[model samples]
Target chain A: MTHALAAKGPTASRPKPAEFIAFAVLAALLAVAPFALYPFFLATALCFALFASAFNLLVGYAGLLSFGHALFFGGAAYIAAHVAKVWGWPPELTLLAATAFVGLLGLVAGALSIRRQGIYFSMITLALAQMGYFVALQVPFTHGEDGIQGVPRGKLFGLIPLGDDRVMYYFVLVVFLCGLLAIYRIVHSPFGSVLKAIRENEPRAISLGYSVDSYKLAAFGLSAALAGLAGGTKALVTQSATLTDMHWSMSGEVILMVLLGGMGTMTGPVIGAIFVVAIPEVLNRIGGPDFAQWMTVIQGAIFVICVLAFRRGLIGEIAARLRRTL
Target chain B: MIPLLGISTQALFGQLLLGLINGAFYAMLSLGLAVIFGMLNIVNFAHGALYMVGAFAAWFLLTYFHIGYWPALILAPLGVALFGMVIERTMLKRLAGLDHIYGLLLTFGLALIIQGVFQNQFGASGQPYPLPEQLKGGTNLGFMYLPTYRAWAVVFSLCVCLFTWFMIEKTRLGSVLRAATENPELTRAFGINVPRLITLTYGFGVGLAALAGVLAAPIYQVRPLMGADFIIVVFAVVVIGGMGSILGAIGAGFMLGIVEGLTKVFYPQAANIVVFVIMVAVLLVKPTGLFGKKL
Candidate 1:
């Protein structure tokens, strides 16, 4: 509850017309962006954006810093990939199945973790996620270090085939938008308000007669679902779901995305996700034993600097200066 | 030699011994965690990295300086403690009045940095540490063969854990530490140099992790990832033990270790996740943990 996440929770009541127009413009830009941007790169960025937005719901809004979200993201990706590649499930079916599985995963994780407060809560989620990672590493279906690869994009609902890169890009784009809107609605909903209240002052919210744990659990569930949606879509986009997706480092990356974008702000995670995803790729372009190798080090430096100097992140800082929620 | 289930007595004892050794590591690491949390109110997410540093210190001492295991045990922890104190003085102390999560984040960041640096310097494939002459070979127990180094690990860590417990729970110095934990301002009122004490306490806790690391070097490959691997399990151990009670941390660590060992013998698939499953069950039944007094 320090820095931007602690600042006036959900100050804006709703997504304004301007904000709606802004989103429409952004969506439009994204749609026409294949000529300007790499489809795979854009798809990856969108997937992470969705992941970060989901993360922001708990962290930015509810003040729950879950360090093990990879359970949903990577775990769902694994499920989606396995179903799609082996079982030959349709894209829609795989997405739905993955989302459902991860949502259930989230509920159990949230239920266990929400019992503790503060640092203990973070640690529990992390430990559980790490256990999930162990399962991924050891379990037969996950293929251990090899991961599930060359997964077919397949047909969405057995109708629209998503074999082409453009079609896959739009599929990812739509999923990202839908997930983003769902998060926006959740954050602005009365339920979202309660989450904010719990986040702001748990004791006060409890005294006010709200079933705080349920609200927290519900938030956790929704967050995990959206994160699942992103991950499942990512498997389709990348045509693979590697162990990298579920690693604790990926969880750390998602946190960085949320922190970098502006934890509570709608656009923050999206902007942050894109920025973070691009940095390593940019460094890799300058590949050597020196510069590219420094990516992880730089990423670690970003975490330290963000916590120490700028917790509000880029969009957060902008919003702070403008005296408005970004 | 009693075999409870269909599992052989020999196998059971071996797993139990292995579990005991793991529990020893858990107890020592959790003790460090509990100490830091009680005094500094910081979760010290960098703990695993610090442990990694300790193991690497041993590796470096032997690889370059030709320092033997005995001296590395003393010197490695001392160096790590000093580094930890520097961390406390510069970075963590700045976040005194802020939310504790900042401390968690800052330390997590430090963990990433430390781990990243280690990974960069030493590739992910672990460097092996040779066994010291003093702790090599094995003794044949009535039930199972026990490696001397593993036996030493369990015994040495238990002694350290108990010594730490004694110092913090039984002595006048322990009372002062307790007073500071309760109310730093009140303790500072008595001219006790509370800030310095806080720094030293963090150092001591970090030293505990380093000590565990040094012990583990001969057992496991000295790798950058070793601490990260163990730290999460230790965190689960801490959660079950309850953060407030030192004895609880020590006891729970050992118990869970045995539980894990038994699980490995019976249900191997569930071994890695058993502690976490237990943590979830504990939270469901008692969120305050086994011995936790506070919410």
Candidate 2:
């Protein structure tokens, strides 16, 4: 048990040169991924990858398992879509506006949810997000069950038009890369160490004079904002923002990605996201529509298997083999 | 036909009765959750799914085998308890001594699989459950008319909750259960079969949930997704009441249900979120919940 917790915890080692090279290689691959794969699919995967990474920041580092991240991800999508379609905001501005709104929402939610510790924290987040879903269902702007749709892929910065699919894909990639870099910065910062300290032993951190709740709230807010970025990017990519984004199932999907890739490792969530997004699409292509119905069951099975046997996850296992923090 | 705050007394009382029925469900489900959490140290996320399964089980007994409600009321919970014990013995046993979060994740996975399979088989729509012959009529009081089944459900669930509380707080088996919960290692040292006791406690809690589901089948439609949304509200109720005391859970459940019903009558717009709003308010003032002891 101790080993399992230790394995999932963050390493305090400095970033090695090989890790930097691997990161550069990954970025280059992503840069060229659009040429080999469908840009739309790649773009969608990137959005989810970002979402998983943002989620990883909380669950992996801070050791706070929030079950309602869908509120931020899906809520931001709604806000971005509404502003782009109704308020005639440009793509970049709309995304920014959405991220900012979700960040504040995160602060409020984090404040209330952090009042309880452990499992209660998870339950509270879930209940709060469900409440948000009901509000979205009743609110006029969200259009209830229909959701906000047909959001324009307006010009980027009012300069480069995103009307073309490739242009929009490139825009998504840029946003995703920037989000990734920001997360990397955050994870490696001194604040990250404090978070890890709290994760390792909260009472010890408190004894050491760190305001643990404040740090947790900050991490939660930042994670929520990054997830918002992913959601906003998704809205622009898909040209729609619907209730599916904010549903509890969506929250479960993100958790699956984080777990599947590897929790607490920077590389795990991205890998997990790619596989999660690709698996469904692959099943749709290979299994026909009838077999597609098994996706939820399959996802559930993965969750069960991961929890029971593969707690280290794909990247975590790989890192264990290489004896280096990925 | 007298109006109270511009609403007829009949409508107000009718909603209040509905609220009480809903409260009975919340009380039962939350009580089950609290019991499971105490024994297992893991919140049972599949609880809602199991409740749904229980409802469907009753429906199956009635539809496929022509078993009536009275028999199903006893049989369904027993079947669910057996199923729960198997899961506890097999899957949950492996997760002992780990962080509480993994149990939640595993059960969550189980919930998804259960809900998904049922959805695939039944689709998303609700199936109607008929009231038994004994519970087919209504009784008119001075203020409002109350359906017999609804009143029975409220009274029966209230009795169950109280009986559970009494058993846990007063009986010898309950004392053993409490001792195991407080100190499993020490209890095991005393030659008590702690693990088996834990298993039975889990079964008891799950059986309670199934019993609630059986009661709910006739009151609400026996739907695949019925437990999904209902469970979240119960969680809020749990948060408000705290999982420390069983009676606290029951009281909170009934109080919040009435509060929700009152919202429907007074301000319809906030009825859906009133429980959640109350949760946030409770959290702000009392972080440990109303009856919760600091862990």
Identify the leading candidate in terms of lDDT. 2
* lDDT (Cα, tens digit) per residue for candidate 2, span A1-326: 32443455444446666557667887889888888999889988999999999999999999999999999999999999999999999998999999999999999999999888899999999999999998999999999889887889999888999978778888988898899889888888677877989989999988877778998999999999999999999999999999999998899999999999899988889999999999878898998877788888888899999999989899898888998778
**Candidate 1 residue-wise lDDT, B10-119, digit = tens:** 89888888899889989988999999998888998889899989999999999999999999999999999999999899888888887777888888888888988888
- Backbone clash count for every predicted candidate, in the order shown: 0, 0
The DockQ scores of all candidates, in the order shown, are 0.69, 0.80
Give residue B36's lDDT in candidate 1 (0 to 100).
93
lDDT of 2 by residue, B121-216 (tens): 988999999999999999988678889998999999999999999999999988988898899999999999999998998899989989999999
Q: TM-score for every candidate vs. truth?
A: 0.95, 0.97
Which portions of model 2 show Cα errors greater than 4 Å? A1-13
lDDT of 2 at A219: 96
The number of the candidate with the highest TM-score is 2
